[model samples]
Target: MSTLTHHKKSVRAMAQHPKDINSFASVSADNVKKFNLPNGEFLHNMMSQQKTIVNAMAVNRDGVMATGAAVFALSYDVTGTRLVTCGADKTIKMWKKDQNATPETHPLNFKPPKDIRRF
Candidate 1:
């Protein structure tokens, strides 16, 4: 028998939050790493802290979804509602932030449909 190993892809996009100076990046390892850029230099070992997986990334807009992630098809809406994400899992999700939300959680939703293709 033979064994196969797959490697996760590197970061897809790196963007700075328009509302804040903090840096945000989505790595293919299913993680959205956040960091603070004191200067131009990137701080090291920051990913080891959160140790979470994101896969995709999007910014906040008009009191809508702030951050979202998936395996693939990551979309960032700079001036709209809903952060759309589609992945290899053959699914699509729409995340949004609700104004009347509570702490430790933001109002967001997802839709599981067939794969979505965008040009």
Candidate 2:
């Protein structure tokens, strides 16, 4: 058996990578961090728009991830290309990866929502 102790805050959720058994994600505060299996090596943080504690998470077969917080629930489409999140605000948001955007462009091109309603 192995143990992972990297999270500085309380871990609220966890999800294994659907296609990669060697890795998994854990949510602490507003950040989702990735870690390797068995070895417990810290991988990296997944990009997110959440500003509060994450309550649930899931990974689809195509590696797409969905995370929910507050009164939200998240899920991915069958194709794994789209992620949908429904929240307490009675709104549903869809997210998809921009194929044309590179890592360098992502930071500049990505726009966060102006307001995130939390319960």
For model 1, residues 8-118, the per-residue Cα lDDT tens digits are: 445655556555565433333533344455543433222321234445555554322233344555665655665777876798877676777775575446442233211
CA-lDDT, candidates in order: 0.46, 0.73
In candidate 2, clashing pairs total 0
lDDT of 1 at 23: 45
Least accurate 10 contiguous residues by lDDT in model 2: 110-119
What is the Cα-based TM-score of model 2? 0.59
RMSD of each: 11.5, 7.7
Model 1, 26: alpha-carbon shift in Å?
5.5
Strongest candidate by TM-score: 2
lDDT of 1: 0.46
Instruction: List residue ranges in candidate 2 displaced over 4 A.
Output: 48-50, 72-119
